[model samples]
Target: MKLKKFIISSLLAFASLTFTSNADAASVQTHRVQKGDTLWKIGMNYGVSVSQLKRENHRTSDLIYIGEILKIPQTISAYEKDLLARLVEAEAKGEAYAGKVAVATVVLNRVDSDLFPNSISEVIYQKDQFTPVKNGTIYNPASEASKKAVNEALVFRGQGSGSLYFYNPQKTSNSWLRSKQVTVVIGNHVFAK
Candidate 1:
């Protein structure tokens, strides 16, 4: 009887473990396109980016009809989002709103690039990649606008200019960085590839 009870407990434990894993594995959230719904509007409504929406739905254009369903990718976790926001807050603290988005994009671009680390934390914390991580400002609470900017960077969904690096020209004399082709100039930050 004791052996049978032990076997039952083991089975119950395995079932619970499987159920927990399945719950954690639930990732996709679907949104059926509504009348007058634009990708930007849908992304804003769902706290995702329009670019992500298009990519996930296999759409090359912004056009979507009513009753069309979209797969929302939640690959980036809350902690990663918060970390990114904090980096934006620290890096582009006094820059324009567009600059803030651009700053976040640099990190995201690195994440996508095979040359850099694959994850946000890895990219941000890698060696001398970001000053905020080195100076410890990355742990500070991200401003509401900064957090919004990070989401917009990840989802605001305009095809990014492929900027891989940004620097304050006034602050950095790194000739190699300055020598790279400049993509866009926003306030004090110069974005380059």
Candidate 2:
């Protein structure tokens, strides 16, 4: 009887310790708003969504005051990171390094935009959204340049543009895409708002 009680107490103690450690590993991070900071930019930097950031901080509007501290919630999963790298490689394999990064940035931008899907995979695999996914090139191994671009994009966020769309103007005859205000022209692709 005494042995059973001892074993039960030990298991309970072990379970408590495991739970505490797991909780500690995933604690939220806080960001101090800078002069040029926006919720979209902040969320990009931290691999979270603007909506998530606002919800965690109890914000009803996008307005974030400079010098205010906001809690940044969870970052992106490893699977999503890999998926973004593959999409970048498939979309901009021959483009310049900056252009590759810009391509990844556009996807991240769309994640923050209200008109697009909320996650990286969703944005990439949306019906008729990306040509690579439709043609099976997205499954190809990611190039080193593409992986680096994804890392840089996550670090630098929008990279000085609020572009949510990009296309190779030479290959695309879509008049609607041409009509959107251009943000930057990197390599063969045009990044637009």
Candidate 3:
């Protein structure tokens, strides 16, 4: 009788664990925002708060591009697929993976410093800082390489070269950079942490 009770308890515990795992797996999904979609609409559809959607998607501005993919916490399967897709895109278009990570790190650092916006979009879109925003590069529909680079940077927390600054050798000439020294150079960019 004792052996039978123990077996039943063990089986019950295992079944409960399996059910919980499945339930977690079934939550979360990725939705690519279309031209007509709004944050509120997406949030309502996903049964999450609009603020949550905006925060998770890292949208500083109210406006969103047509082709941008928004991750929704509706199903785990969709979330993973979108996450993988974004990672691939970042790597493919990222001309300087090292440089990209450095840039990301700088933004993150700034956010932590309390001298800059706390969100990724806010940091990247800050005035006169990032070239992509200033020159419309950020809105240029990021290349696959860039997407991959960004994903790698986000995932790995910007490792490699430890560069906190980079410059185009062809465009910049200053005593400061020369004094700073080089940490790593990738493609047309240089990085320093």
Candidate 2 residues lying further than 4 Å off, grouped into runs, are: 1-18, 21-74
lDDT of 2 by residue, 77-139 (tens): 879888999999999988999999898989988987899999999999889989999899999
Tens-digit lDDT track for model 1 on 1-193?
9999999999999999999998876755888988898988777666677777877889999989999788886647889989999999999998899999999889888888988999988999999988898899989999988988887787754478889999998989999999999999999999999
Q: Where does candidate 3 have its weakest 10-residue lDDT segment?
A: 75-84
Please give the TM-score that candidate 1 achieves against the real structure: 0.81
TM-score, each model? 0.81, 0.67, 0.44
- Index of the highest-TM-score prediction: 1
Off by over 4 Å in 3: 1-116
Question: Which 10-residue window in model 2 sums to the lowest lDDT?
Answer: 151-160
Candidate 2 accuracy as TM-score = 0.67
Candidate 2 Cα lDDT to native: 0.86
Displacement of the residue 157 alpha carbon in candidate 3, Å: 0.6
Q: What is the TM-score ranking, best to worst?
A: 1, 2, 3
Taking all chains together, the TM-score of candidate 3 against the true structure is 0.44
Each model's lDDT comes to 0.86, 0.86, 0.55
